[model samples]
Target chain A: MSAAPRSASRADPSPVPVIELRGAAFGYGEHAVVTDVTLPVHRGEIVAVLGPNGSGKSTLMKGILGLNEHLAGTVRLFGEPADELRDRARVGYVPQRHTLSSSIRSTAEEIVATGRLPRLGWLGRPKATDRQVVARALELVGLSDRAATEVATLSGGQQRRVLIARALAGQPDVLVMDEPTAGVDVASQHVLADVLARLVARGVTMLIVTHELGALERLLTRIVVVDGGRVTFDGPPRRFAARRRARDHAHDTHRHDSELAAGDTAAVVPHGPADRSGQAHA
Target chain B: MLEILTTDFMQRALIAALLVGLVAPMVGIFLVQRRLSLIGDGMGHVALAGVAIGLVTGLEPVLTALAGAVLAAVAIELLRARGRTNADVALGVIFYGGIAAGVVIISKAPEGTPANLVSYLFGSILTTRTSDVWVFLVLALVIMGTLWVLWPRLFAVANDEEYARAVGLPVLPLNIVLAVLTATTVVVAMRVVGLLLISALMIVPNAAGQLLARSFTSGLRWAVAIGLVSAVGGVFVSYPLDTPSGGTIVVLAVLIYIVTAVSMAVVGRLRQRRHEVAESHEHEHGPECGHEAIPHGDHVDYLHDGHRHAAHQGHYDEHGADEYGALSRDDGPTGQDEEVST
Candidate 1:
């Protein structure tokens, strides 16, 4: 409850980045998987963290989300230390959709409703406003009619949207999604990009981790390429295209990259300046 | 029929059974949803060691069991939270270790034979003392009160732990809380359901509930209802049949689970066959029809608009839509529909 009130003057784009990391090193044990990473994600900026199969991109995202141990430097959220920041509601998170176990008995709406838990706290039951927010989230994802449908019965694309709606339901200041377009059909991938475009239009800040950035290429305001452990390139989509071939990002036979390749990587339109550059990563 | 229930021991058994029935499934459903159904079973074994401790020390076995189980639960949960040891490995170590230790510890006690531990192993709810009933009542109140306040949070964690952690719910504490509640439940129901059979009471009724459960909330309610019937009914059944209550209760729950499973499968098949019957109206029997449904049995029936047409054979059979309409309204589409929609 002592969580600092977030900056109300969002119209001016607050000087402090919503999420800031300074020379951070994160890993499970003593060994650092990702090291010496300095990155700042501002409000309303859609930063896509791109990498090859085992480039520690996911590790960096997890470190930002406070899932992994911060072995080295500073990691801050809403301009506060990671451990001291109590208001986790300000950050809506959508993990990899596959992490959700199969055969969940919850409805699409019910799964989304859980996103409201951080706001409601222990004693507060879900009120009408909470229900309305959940409905709005489902509608935003075009699953309003599927509000009562069981999650298990939904298709993979539909389930992914459900996970998106779940993250959106919290009305977080920044949404951190891990591979939002992974493991879905080509049509679904485009639909997800459109959904993301809408979310961006609403000025929602995001930090997405994905191997295939071409699907979300149009909406990406900035690209942060993490090859090996550290940041190799951090610039706009256009700059990333020009600065391509600086390093050999060999994407081995990882499960994620292969799925998108086999499953409609072509249907996702390559951007204006980075068709070949994008295909290199793909 | 009611006179047998009026006896003092019967009243205690019924009351205790009702309480266990009410409480077991509340905790069990989350474990079942998380696929940690066997955690309770492992805790039961740990509680056995606690019971052995109590027997040796001349203290109440239930209290000792509660202490042992809670400590083991917290310890095991801590190990899991550390991200080093998996729950599977912890369960293996503690599950076997607890029982082996109990067997050894009980042998050293003066009044403890392997025979003395029999009641502890299988339960002795009929011979439950008044004080023991009061103790269980208090424990039940504690568990229910905690769950009443935290069931939603507990549910969110069980539904998806990563999401729960992201949402800033104290995932570790809540997990530890669930583990502690599980240990307490092991002690509370152990006298009635027995340590060996108690986890079945926690799981079987919920398994039956999931067959027809519409959602988690509904599933939980169904589980509690099924658990209540199995617990109280098993008590009554055991009285007349001269059988063990714990065994009878677990058996009854398993029977209900089988019945529910068989019925659900039957309903699903009936829905598909009935859908085939419903399809004959718009469906024409030809290669152009492109109708391939349920590659089971000899043929598929197209039941639509009061006529059943045999698929691919250009044969039409008349049927009553009235009789089949009830089947059409069956819960929702079967698993077969998932293929068509996706």
Candidate 2:
């Protein structure tokens, strides 16, 4: 069964975007990293945001997650203003793997149980339903056997899965991940891809910020490429590949013929995967 | 030891020590985990200023110290939130400022002020009044109750602050509450370990517990146990040795930390050797032994230095290398390339 769009109905008529950003700019403090970007993520859609380092892809995701407030324009979650959305449990966030410090000595079960914090009461006691949800999340990530294991003792791949399980336990309608596969092993990446596929099949909307598409290439319904703090391209993966190749060719000829000004060099050098895969695609 | 416990003064001191011991480490465990161990020191300095204020005004030093500490805690949190400086820098500013202010305030006070200041600074557990014991008891209950109610939120914030914020955990209020708790712990512990050594009481036992513990709950239990033993044992030893009570307690706690750290290293080495032996045996046995016998070397490496090992392992992994390549290729003009590796 396909995942139903949350809160979408005939009376509403339109499928409310799970995440909506119009001319949004986001950054830390006074410095804006992602600017003038308009993007909408519909229900059940898997969107991959690709960008170079310091290109503000993560910042954009942070804006949607409300970790970083939008400096400009409007950001809406489930048809509500981003900052005003009270139902945070509906949007689960899986940050980069290293975000969890090594000093944290929690078991996988304990970590997954934390995802239930929003659903829990002030005392933060996990009810039977919470426990069952946490268990199911661990099972979904194929980590039920390792549920009691200390996260510190788990492999990098296993730790990543635990993080995914933590987000899943929230039962969020939308999953936002920042560089899910970065620094992960190839085998683990494949495992993550399978997990993402299952999540998609379950109708969970995903907005992922990543450098390399790799195994995630197949699961993506749309790809958004950011360059120099702006959304340069947003379309289907196939069209992205086609457009990227054409852009790379034009960039190559421009680089070879032009006097190579600093501005020219910066513009031609597609940050992140675009630069590395430029030749491969050509 | 039994004879020493007979006197009313000794009994009061021991009770205070035990009470501070139980609550201090409970608070300290969270502080250490959050890398805010020095917050105890900062609050201790502020407590000194409070003590000076009490001396000059003829008020109860403990109550004044508690008030001073709470105010200082709020100020530190405010400064940190305002981004006037980084956390450590802000803490350092308040830490030294409080001590300096206390010194200046004490200098202008009555004749006995300096002596009282010294006692507070170094701690005089033998001189701990019955009223002080009651105050410590009340503070312990309040602090422990607060921690009990806020355990999950505090743990989430301490473990991964960004994740806590993303999950809509009230990170700011939780942080302020933690700061206030740290202040309370420091103020209460100051009677046993002194303002100067309060952080030792707040850090050493928790540090030792972290080394020995494999889980959060176990770490907390171990910390409280270690702290209690150190407090009572230090007082017991101090009476016989004729040493300072606060210094003795801090020394014992430090000794526990050192011993635990060294033992962890020794144990890690032995485990590494065992893993090496197992790996060699697997190599000799060939493909039938399976990849399970291959031994995840990173696990052993992590025990040595988890942060560095994790970073290195991330770099050494196949995907990390690919990302590194992609990163290096993108290092075009900004000269900010090394960031991607980290």
Candidate 3:
């Protein structure tokens, strides 16, 4: 039976969150990767989880994917425990670009067909309609022509797009991508941005982990900042920007004070070295 | 060829080869994709021990072998998962233990049963009974049918486990299916190729298949083709040359792999050279000619291109924050916006 429009409305409208994690903590063995984190992801929103390497962004994503053991707190996806949401035909995941080893010689379309695998019968051959869906997914990612191309031959960015196509093939309620634009060229980045923009327009819920602030800044509705395994900030992009500006200004003042304390000798000493190097070069 | 086909044992061996060729390679697709080719070897060794135990105990060898292999496979999985040990390590432990137990069980008897030993270790296709052939055929059919149903799930798991799980595929059951199919293949193969050479049967076909084909499905077809050829071909070779059927089949499979590997290498090189020539021609036309556009289509093109342009490029920038000074930070509005449609 089709879910009623009224039911969708009553469940959670716009600002109402679909995923809520409260004081979440997770770790590998003894070392904690995420701790005391609280964040909410809403439907039809692109929330970028930003942090440095090993800063718990991936850990957070893993928690949402229900891969990691939650040491503390709760993660609810679509108002259900992340693990308990078995009808995750609603969820699409494109893992980190390198998660798949390219030594495997599958075609782009074949890889995309994997997205429909969970929905297939026990002997999971793709039916005629499933093949059509795979084609549609490849076309959506602008990879229709490369459907027969081996994944090992695709450029990094195209592979990323192929991975997205694989996720999109499922026609999920939520799409989670980790660092899609990483190691890709600017043109590929632009193409991927265009694709994400199109998906966003179509109301696909997206959680993208990216470092391309300029590109993601234009796409994301909310910025969830994590530091030391905690949600340091979860708000609008503008608010995040404002907070950073304030923090930077304070940091700049602090640096300036330290520079002033070091006195005028530093600038003169560096200038002499630069002038001598320039003259010697000339 | 007609005379060979006329004999019941030859026909049985040929049919057995066809079935083993199909099932082994089908399952090998997943095993090869997962870089667990040696698991096939480990399971085969375990199967040998099972056959030995069956001979010593006087039980039906095929059934006992299947059960032992399934147990060993599950044991291997459990040990590896629980201990976080490398699969090879777990396999090593089980492989040796299984054989030692089998040897101890076999040595308990004073009078040696060389017929049983020959059948289990080296394989005697001439001794294969019609009843056993029927049993092999049935088991192979059932395993293949089950594998056919679980293809997508198995492929997903082989490609990436967490991604499959995230999309709600029952990864655990699918893993069990893979192990069980492997066990079934070992059992079917035991009647012709014997236990010691079963891994070769599973792996060589796939190795040969991957070299000759492009897609995983194509690889499967090619594996079966090569396997069937080697099986029937090996039987023919053995009959004329007075050699062991199992050894002959394995050798033929290896030879096929070698030839395929050499040919694939040559073709790959030629293709690379052609692409280079094309790339150079495109480059001669200059940047405006869209020489830059082609690199984005290849997987490793970024590593070759990005070093000259972007500093700290493609690294995950957390929360679109302060690390990337060149990019503007713009986190727009918060929460559900009507910008996204249902």
Candidate 4:
């Protein structure tokens, strides 16, 4: 396993990455959707995966969640190989909001309680502590009032919170969410942001996949940009935005040369006339 | 009706009906909730082929039919898992194929075979033997025991299969177990309600229970209650009215379903109106309440209860078609044609 240095410390040798992927390729069937990805997520960091539509951002999240087939390379969770990490309760996953079939007539509390399935012994009923944890999860997501409400009766935003609360009820060390703000109203996004900020303050490791930053931009510790099934940029959010602005400026100045440089590393690096002269001297 | 119970055959028939009534709906509730209600009918068709095979081979028809239904259930599950065809399409193909095979096999048999086949097709509850009653009792006990032990895991799988899988539950085996249980229930039910009317027993009472009950366990109890009432009541009514027992039972079940569905809708509407009035009153007291209420308006106006209007609309359309097919097969053109041919 390649031990990547944490961004917070340059020389620290003991801080293990909570999640590590080395040249990982994930997909379904024979096709690899996300390939050659190397990333490490440490504790107490909120990493946002930003990408265009159909750019394999969701696939990358699924790879981390072990929802998809890992065709090649290694994925480590909590310092162990992903496949060997059998204690799934340590990692929480909040999937993208999809309409649950109406036949499943469970309340928000009941759905949240299912998160404790990994913790409970087979055939064991929910204990008082489990119920309290469920209640606390609901409270964390601002859904305490809707605890007894049927999930189908709740609005989309409320349903999303219920899903998040379900993951929280497991008391996981790492929380991964896919498009948590997509299709959510602005007010609900702000509420999610507030809840996430609290989770960050509590030292929960978060990996979020989203197309747009929206309300979550302020909370992002790092931004990883994926394009064409590969990670194109990995750095702080401000540097990403600055690099993007510089690239756009270069595109406006020299459209033909920018087109020619599309697949090159220089397309990503911020380049202007001054940088070109400095590069020539070097 | 009470005097009819004095006869030996009537006593056996009553026992059979009661056993089926209590147990069939217990399995049926899961099938209906999973939207696999048609599987009962499909298995019934498969059992018909088994009965025919038994008659030609000089074996016990009930035992043969049970074997056939179970094999068909396993086949259906395997095929569905393979995703070769959609569930309904696969069931339809197997169902019609089974019936067609039975017809061919029965047609090749002696003249007396068709008469016996019709009895199995439409059910002859009054002709049930003591041994049949014993078989029904054993089957009911087995079904109930297995379900009791596996209820929580089965419920989890039925409720959300993918989520259950993610939680490391044995979904595939639970599904197969459920299918096997359903097949057993169908075979047991065939002796009382007949192949044509078996699905009505499995679907109507359970769907009605879902409409009336607020929770999963309560819904199951309601279904069993409804099934028992319809079964016992239909037998009593059939004795007095001189009607076919299976047809009467299905009709009673369908009637109960309609009444419960209408009443639940009425109750839901009333509660919705009351809640709206309270919300509007709050809006009048404080303009800020209006802003708080707008999102809820769309939710209640469309969803009302947890039941999604669109999903229910689709379900009703499909259910209506199935009910129509079941009723027609029970006493309509198919039944008349069989009588004429025989």
Candidate 5:
């Protein structure tokens, strides 16, 4: 879910690192989901996490939220262990999939206002300011006009945006999204990306778990690659591409040798500088 | 109707109905969201078993039934929390075990105990006691208050538990609280609606509410409204017809649900046809509606990710021509992450 914990480096510093994962290892019973990984996200950074299906990317995301008690390692938010991190008020999350109650019958604005729960204190109602924030979130997600629309009648994309708006209503310091672009269309993807980019520009630290990195690369500050529950690469987007190339080459060579034994030329290709660097790194 | 409210027993029944109205549907929202509609059935049966046990022991039947219901609720919660299998499957197993256990417990009791058990099963709303009314009020207040405080957290966790936790909401306790509240409501409402009819009170209003309401809160409010109306209205109709109040209430609720369902279906069909007509017109012309149909948001761009590389290289070859990839771009934000056609 996170990268190796780094102490506040003087090279770059903000008020504080919003999230830190140190040697984090997460798993379901008897299955290690994510292992021996650390990730640090500070304000104003857009990080994309990439991994194959079953590669434990979602588990790492969950681990940071303390949803799955990772078997080994620690997760910290705002300098406290995740479990003790009470600044939930500063964290917002949009899920990969949402299973809403069938009985749910709220409007989009009302749904967005719910994001203020953590910030509203016990027994607190939404204040005038809270309503303004909700409106802002709706506007950010381009749902203000549909604020009064029935949530159930919304298209899937609108619902997803509503979820994002709900998260944004929290005015979180860190917005964590699990595959925020999973089931939307290309234009909506741009809208969502632009919105998220704008959020990043506003200094909201974002940790996004997504396989759809082509378009997302334009918005990210860094990229993290995970495979078999471990951090294989954590740096810029190019580093991820380089890592992907290495893994692919190793896999391709295995296929090549098998194909050669069968005298198949179709699988063979000349190596290039990019391939060599990836191979060297591997 | 006004005269009925003047009678002490009638007042008790009204109070009980009002209390059950709020509690049942409030908890029903959670059950419906989880798709465990039969949980009410399972818990209702368990409470009936408790009532049978109480009748044999000559204890206050309602109290004993409540205690049994609370224990059953805890068991259900524990099994569900383990998360090894589907919650519905776990509920089925627990409820069946409960029924069997109740049968054995009831059989061991003295003769004539079955009559008391029958009342628990069928309910005797007209006979609701003053003490029962007070208990129902207290329980309803507690449940409603808990919902008021936990509404947002509950909504968040219900949408996605893992996501809620990541955002730092206490999800586990809230779930347990919901289950406990359901247990209490099951016991409290049993006397007014009976075990057999209690779930009707829960599901009917929610079903109707779901048809017309716009949001979760609106659905709840509508469900509560329907329930109160049916409860009071049932009493009115039952008195003139000389019928059992529980049966009357259940029947009336079903009637209301049917009316709401039919109207919603008609309205929904009309809306869909209109939308399709508008869409076809746009296709023939160009963006006449002016509101461009937004494809689902959150569409992933598959080309840039390693998945595309895998697809091109024949890695995970089985996924080549996989519909998931096609769906991915379809789901991406419009015009952003389209895959280059091979």
Candidate 6:
């Protein structure tokens, strides 16, 4: 629904994509997890990567972020080879938030300020501008007041917001989020959705790897589905939903016949209305 | 007591204690943060072998121990950084070998070296030479100067290694630096806090510091304060009580940790009772109240202090955007927050 108006307005957009992957294969060590991926994320586009567990969705994102090794084909960030990208601060990463260590005694502000480390190397300290950026990032995530509070003292959702703020603090051109809404409650998901919506409104580009789509489905411009370690589908969210619905109907008729159906439908499906995922991961 | 504080040896011991107290926790807080709380212990164990090497070869034990610990630290880091199964097993083997080798090697030294080993195992404060104090001072300065340049990066790496690397802050190198710092601290403190018990000085004060401090900045301050008291106080305590300075300092730190823990526990209980009192004070909060009312979920939350409170089943329920209410009362709201959208 949100993609139609944006697509119509993109008649004179940037020529080069923020991230481009061509026939790319990504994995840890010598083993390839995802292969032959052709994807380009442009400015102001929110792309959702969907897949079954261990289906290489994460590996693809990691490959783009230069975490996973690119075994075959090319991966580029901001038109530069992933490995050769000199301006690292151009990309922001929101890793899955772990339980904050209580003993570390880091405040929310301290945690978010670290996002500026790329710009200010180990020896350089955070100046006025850096502090302003950190404060603005905290404000973007609606965590301005929680800045001084110990991260351990924050709620799960608040902790998650702190992580997003940490990413935003970097002032990156593209945000790479790996399951930003995973393991969070509905209300927290909604809050995270609002934060992301605000960010998108500011023209922040995003490439998210998530199984659950309910929280961010409305804002999604396109859906890329990775199955059997390949890009099976790449289209608008509505088309993807429709296609999955038809596939699920065919799958349901044979559900009883196949004893070893790979995915558990309920488990793979996002928890919301029927159209949220329409069916299990394809 | 006053005269003991005046003697050159006593004064030197006190200065050394102060320096040990100051620097041990400075390096220690990061170690504790990395969950490598016992890395200092491992380094300490390894440094003992270096000490034995010095004693047997007739060199300064402190300098030899420093060299030993630094080399072992780098080797352990390189192996651990390689990230394999045997690296872990090798680490354990090395640590075990260090202590056993130290004991075995020290036995081969001159007859009086065995007697001298007592001061190395448990600190003998009066025996802390002038040169040892200068070594401690220089090493302490080096540790502090390094931390000053790398504090934020170190904290970031310690807090989350993957995130730090994602942001491109050289995680492995920082971790290596931390290991080296642990080694340097262990050996520098050996003459005063004994190689055997050096880790206690490194960790216990920081542990105690965390019991009361809620922020990293404050935690560092608290740890240093606790370390100073324990180290300096231990020396003073040993003079009157006739105890080993190392044992006294470790015991003092443990005692401080115990007291802080018990005190915090009691305060938490009191806070629980205080909640009941606040319940009685709770009046109807609506449009008439001056406090700003923010919409929260199914109900309305009144923004007071830093967090929001909503009425739930006739009692005030703490409200959060995610409904995962985290109520820590010490912190206050500093500025305006972006509206949580519906």
Which candidate leads in TM-score? 6
Model 2, runs deviating above 4 Å = A1-14, A244-282, B86-89, B111-115, B276-342
Model 5 docking grade: acceptable
- Cα displacement (Å) at residue A131, model 3: 2.6
Structure candidate 4, residue pairs in collision:
none
lDDT of 3 by residue, A162-188 (tens): 889988888888888899888876655
Please give the distance, in angstroms, between residue B266's alpha carbon in candidate 4 and its true position after superposition: 3.2
Ranking by DockQ: 6, 5, 3, 2, 1, 4
Model 3 Cα displacement at A230 (Å)? 1.2
Q: lDDT tens string, model 1, B1-342?
A: 898678888788878888888899999988887788888988999999998888888888879999999998998888888777466686689888998999899988875333367777776656566787898899999999999988878888888898888778889999999999999888888877888988999899888998887677888899999999999998888888877778888899999999999999999888657643334332232211233222224434433333344432222443334354536645432333223212
Put down candidate 2 lDDT per residue, B262-325, tens digits, no spaces. 9999998996565321111101111111111122342311111111112121232111122223
Q: What is the Cα-based lDDT of residue B190 in candidate 4?
A: 77
Each model's TM-score for chain A is: 0.81, 0.82, 0.81, 0.84, 0.80, 0.83
Encode model 2's per-residue lDDT on A163-210: one tens digit a residue.
Answer: 888889888988998888887766567767877887877878889999
lDDT of 4 by residue, B1-342 (tens): 468889787777778889888988888877765777778888889888988888788777788889989999898888876656386687788899998888788766656643366667777676577887788789889999998877766776676665565546666878888888988888787767888788889878888887876556767889899999998788777777877778888899999999998998999889656531211110010111111211232121111112111111101101112322334444322221122111
* Candidate 1 global CA lDDT score: 0.78
Candidate 5 structure quality by residue, lDDT tens digits, B190-234: 877778778788788988998877667778889999998998788
Query: Whole-model lDDT for model 4 versus the true structure?
Result: 0.74
User: Using lDDT as the measure, which candidate wins?
Assistant: 6
True contacts kept of each: 0.30, 0.38, 0.44, 0.06, 0.52, 0.44
Candidate 4 residues A165-247, lDDT tens each? 88888789889888999998675576678778878878888899999999889888889999899999999877888997887
The native-contact fraction of candidate 3 is 0.44
- Which one wins by lDDT: 4 or 5? 4
Which 10 consecutive residues of model 5 chain B have the lowest summed lDDT?
B277-286
lDDT digits (tens) for residues B1-342 of candidate 6: 699978898898899899899999989998888887888888888898999999899999889999999988998989987778798789898898998898899988886754377788788887888998899899988999999999988888888777776667787888888888889888778877898888999899999999888789999999999999999999999988989999999999999999999999999899766553123222334333445667655446666565566643334665543233235534434332222224
What's the C-alpha lDDT at position B141 in model 4? 94
RMSD of each: 11.5, 11.7, 10.2, 15.7, 11.2, 9.8
- Alpha-carbon runs more than 4 Å astray in model 1: A1-13, A242-282, B86-90, B108-115, B276-342
